[model samples]
Target chain A: MRSWLRSEDSWAVLTGLLVLLLGLLSLAGVNALGWVPKANEWTTPLKAVSPASKAFALPGGVSVLLLYTSLLGFLCLGAWRMGHSVKRFAVGFTVLFAVGYGCWVLGHYAHLATTPNKMAEKGITWGLGLTSESGYLLALTAGLLVGNFFPKAGEWLRESARTEWYIKTAIVIIGGVYGFKAAEDVKLTQTVLVRGLAAIIEAYLIYWAVVYFLARKVFGFSREWAVPLASGISICGVSAAITTGAAVRARPVVPVMVSSLVVLFSVVELILLPFAAKLFLTDEPMVAAAWMGLAVKTDGAAFSSGAITAGLLTDDPAQQQAMGLTTSTVKVFIDLFIGVWAVVLAVVWAYGVDRKPGQGVPLKDIWGRFPKFVFGYVLAFAGLLALGLWLTDPVAKKAVKEGMEQADQLRRVFFVLTFFAIGMGANLRRLWAEGLGKLALVYAISLFGFVIWFGLLVSWLFFHGVKPPTVGGN
Target chain B: MPDDKRTAEELAKQQAEPLLPAEKWLIFGSISLGLALLGVLLWLTGAM
Candidate 1:
């Protein structure tokens, strides 16, 4: 309904859909989104900015200006519709975009981001070899410094710091990225999709039950507290915890407490798991990739972990693509189906557990609880896939190359912004706050003691032998 | 009692209660689903 526009999830979907549609117009020889800016690895700052599409050449300054104006217009429209002050949002957003994208450009400095393979070409004997995704980490660090050290700036930027919205939008764009690849190699795509499906099902059914048992019996938490905590730790973190709280009709404070812990632990996972995967599971690239999706709780953290893992594990572009694709496939499937799991819990609690005389669990609740942005992700993926299969002309090829590539660049920009927003949202001081001690202890125990290792085992079961397609497959 | 203290007492008291029949069913159902899914995955991957 028209009222849905107020939801950030709907706005993310709409924004992503608009980008996809504009990109698709290139199949008709229209280059509407070609002006979007992309930063490249560079020794000098001036060389960093360029149009995303190789087909269109524009002045670097013009490219950045065009991207800035376009993003502000689109996002400001959403803010206005959502009953936010467009003026304040625009002011905050401009500062965020400038600083966040500056961090992005800084992260791409040749000395910092040039991979080992390209070290010689960049005339650098030594480089961090973190790949360009270091931008994400830099952006996060920059935002955290502001959030903790400069509280006023952080508060001012709060109006535009929509972490989940940015990440969900990026995920929709990534769906197109994979969908375009799927068009080229249907068999490999089929394999990862099926594998990802299995991984998420196993994740939900096994991980949730185990965590719930531990929280209730081992940690001595009440059913009210344990349910949301289980959902948060074993499933997709904040969204899962919030939905499960609603399903079980628990106090709102229960989910809020659980969600804060989920955020804290997810940040921990984001920092540690990628390096762990690189060290232990690099030989099994797909396993490492799927492990990130399965283990990391938040979408931003999960996807960012995947990107960082790809950078750490190998310098090969093909292997990196493979890893990113596998992680996104698994995480997206998990995000897509959490609503059904919530519905199941609702029925079980209402009908079988409490059995309150007047209370009824309606099927319509699933619709209300469903994440609408997933629809955008599915639409983008399926639409791109259908187009890829249906069109085979030179113009279509150009569209696939230039348009999709530009869309990928836009997706990366969103990802960097998401990292910054996530960091800005996380208040490190809150972890030490009173009344969170029990929740934090339960999380630390359940997550590290069992959940993470179990996730790795499940990921290996599903994705062990699978390999991403070679570079030319793209 | 303060809200936090009351809530904590309630949680602790509930924790000592025996597992409800419905909770048992939920656990059983989840494990069954997990096993079935694992079986299907093994078959699909030719690992069975």
Candidate 2:
């Protein structure tokens, strides 16, 4: 078990389970005792107080900040003990503390500033929609400049950039949100689930085939470049690129390069997909929401785009709420496929592609290479789903919702950390030298020529005419 | 004399990078079809 905790996935799953357990317990105890925190309330604005840690506030009004900072410091210390330099850990922790909290505050304010309702109240009439794209864009840009122009600082920042762990943990927490949120309207969720499942299949089959062919035939890339590039273009870009890199046994640079492209293009899609979805698919709103999931690969970009698209296109508040829910359902459906997709690809690579003749691809290889944190995600999802099903009582149902509300808040904090970590690791100059110019061209052509249109068509075919209930209680 | 010769041979090998597998087409093609089927099953049962 001590050895097990060294792995990123194992730590993520254990932490996620701990979070889920604590949330359930704290909510249950509070309900039973009729006690509540003085300053405990859930809202998106910045107050230095968090829903999750508010119950345990200290004498100073700095409980959440202290807890959050300590959690990161411990993670840093863990990495240091695991065989990193003290200087690197020191530099990394400083940057992580500064950048993580900085991005959170900036994203919060950007969200408030760009919100359409707020802008409308000020008589501005036109503003960026509900999404928090501005802060992420700023973080990515600052990272790129630092990575290229000030390489020393970037190196320090990159010390704590455990992008995979951060993202994986958030994904595990997202599973709980699904179980809790999906219970509200079973019918709509089922539809989103089915359609999203079918759509991901089409996406994997059609999109991967076309982009891969283009990479090989058109761009003249070798299999390593083609496969990772295709994976980044076809499915959830960051994880897909990493998985393909490992499956193909490519160099470490290959995944990093591919991931850089994914991060850059995610920002592009963040700016473009929502406006396009609104322009075309307003009446078929759910389709637009699903298209956001299919087209944009990163979680922040996809959900932010969905929120913006939903806000811009729909005037009905209930419809907007439905759109938000449907958006998560579709995105999680696509995100969950990475685990299964990784296994299948590993088998194909080991057995069918790169193996020495007569050397069998052992099952153990696949299991070892497999992402174990995915089990935590699926288990959490299933547990919550079961919980939702069993909690037929009204009070029990309400408790589940409140508990998950805190979980989702923590998930967003993890996601914001993930964004900073991903950005810190990226260097545009390296990306360019590693064939970003060519890769960018291929990515653009693949995304615009096939990915976006195909996603739109399939989304429309499956999710068209599915309107959420307005002016009715679930 | 043998060590020098071995070093020269290793340097030559280091400079040459191998091309990707010839079986890539067959690999991705077959796997994509299989994944599609798996996806259909998942959708049919709403399992995932």
lDDT of 1 at A362: 52
Q: For residues A187-251, what per-residue lDDT tens digits would candidate 2 score against the true structure? A: 87777776666556765676877887777776777676777788888877776777666766666
Each prediction's DockQ? 0.40, 0.11
Alpha-carbon lDDT of model 2: 0.64
lDDT of 1 by residue, A1-474 (tens): 778989888998988877877787887788888888889899877898888776668977888888889899999999999988899999998988898888888889998899888889988899888788788889988888888889889999999988888898888887787677677777777777878887667668888998898887777787888889999998888888878788888888887767877877887898899889878987788899999999999888999899888888877766776788888888888887788888889889898888998887754655665667878888888988887888788667767767877888888889888888878877787666555567688888888988789889888877887777667653
Q: Candidate 2 lDDT, tens digit per residue, B19-41?
A: 34544554476457846675566
Classify candidate 2 by CAPRI docking class.
incorrect
| lDDT: worst 10-residue window of model 2 chain A | A33-42
Q: How do the predictions measure up, each by TM-score?
A: 0.94, 0.76
Judge the docking of candidate 1 as incorrect, acceptable, medium or high. Answer: acceptable
Cα lDDT listed for each candidate: 0.82, 0.64
